[model samples]
Target: MSKAFSAIDEDREVDRDAFTPGVEPQPTWCPGCGDFGVLKALKGAMAELGKDPEEILLATGIGCSGKLNSYFDSYGFHTIHGRSLPVARAAKLANHDLEVVAAGGDGDGYGIGGNHFMHTARENHDITYIVFNNEVFGLTKGQTSPTSPKGHKSKTQPHGSAKSPIRPLSLSMTSGASYVARTAAVNPNQAKDILVEAIQHDGFAHVDFLTQCPTWNKDAKQYVPYVDVQESDEYDFDVTDRREAQELMTETEEALYDGTVLTGRYYQDEQRPSYQAEKQSRGDMPEEPVAKRYFDDDYEWERSFDVIDRHK
Candidate 1:
């Protein structure tokens, strides 16, 4: 662990209220907004894990979901549109002891930041990525987002969108995310449980969170009566089996558009080493946090100008 985070490792019983800022800013979200559920569940999950706010980092992208950093009392970075993952990845690589989480809306994550989403999962970065999948772009006046259902009408697509929605769970699994799951804001219990597991996971954990946009997506199903795959006997499949997970994910994705919301852990591969672990195993990364080395006064450090002059 890095010297920077050595103090954070001290064990202490954490309270959920500890995450709330001293000056609580009332959320600006519209009435019945699902973002409130996310905040509550996240706080609950962190409290359950007994993680200190100083030990966690929250990186968010542009959109209503980006406001997560404002509400979450943690080390936070509000990055540009669709860039939360890259920033979170850098932080994790610099200080491996920090628990990193990246969050954004569907438009920001699956649309503008789709490449980052794919590559980050492909590289198996050790971070929890939460995509608030509300179908429409809630912050931008309800435009048809990447996860918008086929033929879904919006301000941008008054005649209804012609494109099919992206299957985030299947895509994450295919791209090598070691842990993948879907949860809804309406199901606070499930959401909290999933978040706790995701945070504790040692590999890339992708959570496709179904957030209802009551103001914009009034037509959206409230994600009620969500069937938990792990709890339901009707849907039995090995979470460790890639083929089984893929098949279930396909069915779940298709069912979402049809009004059935299936939510739970679809895949988990605990044996796969995370990117940071792989680098350390290969002796490419130092055991200490990279951030610590930069402040070493006694160590010789090369300046950028000196390197440029040498090259010249």
Candidate 2:
């Protein structure tokens, strides 16, 4: 039996009057949280992409950044800690038409959800993963996170963080993500542009924003100052060339310590096939063998055959 269904193509049209004042609820971050800029960038990117807020799906994990979903007017999932990717992936698989975005703080993504991050990139799912790299876990009260620099003292790492900070851009490039980019929360224009590019990209697009958590990460200002914004010359790296992307990652690391901030799309591939391609590529849904064998009029025979097949 075939079932009739109707889908609302709400995303195709934009409502100029759709957004009301304070549509996006104010996030519950500290007074001067860098996540505010990240949120603004995302909203700006969505507007730039002409995506209807009703047609968007934002999934977030538990953290300061996770609270972001509550502020957006789109369909959102405030998932358990370190599980934003699965929620976002499931949403996309269920409805490939919607623009699915997963977001969380560095601790939520890189520390607990690091495995999921790897697999998600490898699968090359057509979704955008935004990481707010604040270096410290602000929600859990000023603990050192995975991206926290070595020798950075925090509540959890008072004597200084033991391990080195994880290079998210390099990790993303190595994970087979079709698109990878990095920007700072302070640079909203560049951040919005990168986010827009990531959202429009075919496969898994990872955008890591170095955000500042004033309440927790006091030293974050050294890299991302509130008043002083560092600008770097844009280097055009062949996104399709993996070697070139890797070299760019190395150069970016050097630039970071040398006090030059890197921004813009570091990697991308327009030719990569999206996740929806597999299901859509099938010639057509197959007919049941039982239907072709006249099983509709012979349920007893079909049931016997099913039992026999199962035993075999």
Candidate 3:
């Protein structure tokens, strides 16, 4: 075949090794970064899903996790800080067939974009939201974030943090996300399982990954490492039971610094209708950009400039 034809075929079909090379430039992450685990799990999940690279839209916010977009050969958008959800929701609404994923670090998702996170879950859009929870802000050179543990010291908190850490899993559960999960970056297999399941869910899904940032969270060596599933019994994973999941999130009796990585689904409800699926069923899908399917003829001028000129 000609070189042009070969190139065309390559675009039409994914190369087996395309995603295998993984993130480019070998990831500038510091030694023992949790983002690495999440990346592997994401690639594995995408491979398992067997979807076209173009059909996958990985939207990310500014942070260490945002850099993930650069590595994947699939369609990716590196949006402003805390804005990934809005973009992902829009993408999914525009093209219901696309597999949209919103990913970002804790600060990006819970700090600046905290409000958006809540609304996104309540909306129940058909998109996957993954938060890389490292406790500390690794990108801003070791700063305290919303999820930073109380009494945790950082450049921004010289005398230990004073504010309470935001419990993302519990918050998402209460926010009405149809699916919720928490996984350790160390457990690539389990992470893949949880992510794929979340993506397959019809409504909004959330997967919070507790990863280590050795450079920023000085206690990385004491807390982060490979996942020990058999030993994770101490961490509650009764996802079907919201009260139990909330208890687990609040019960930090065995914190990561104590050497127990939390992993498992927190909640799931396949029955919940996705934002797009519900709209399509009710014949509420927007036919024009400005309004829904039942827009009045007066709005025709908005759809075409030529029509307005001819009418004038």
Each candidate structure's TM-score, on Cα atoms with residue i matched to residue i, is 0.94, 0.82, 0.81
lDDT of each: 0.91, 0.76, 0.76
For residue 113, what is the lDDT in candidate 3? 95
Error of 3 at 193 (Å): 1.1
Q: Report residue 53 deviation for candidate 2 (angstroms).
A: 1.6
Among the numbered candidates, top TM-score falls to: 1
Candidate 2 has an lDDT of 0.76
Candidate 3 Cα misplacement greater than 4 A, ranges: 1-16, 20-23, 222-238, 252-259, 286-312
Candidate 1 lDDT, 151-236, residue by residue in tens? 99988999999999998999899988999999999999999999999999998999999999999997776888789999999998
**Ten contiguous residues with the weakest lDDT in model 2:** 1-10
lDDT of 3: 0.76
Error of 2 at 29 (Å): 1.2
Report RMSD (Å) for each prediction in the order shown. 2.8, 6.4, 6.5
lDDT of 2 at 29: 81
Residue by residue across 29-77, what tens digits does model 3's lDDT show? 8777888888888887877766556567899999899988777657789
Model 2 clashing residue pairs (backbone): none
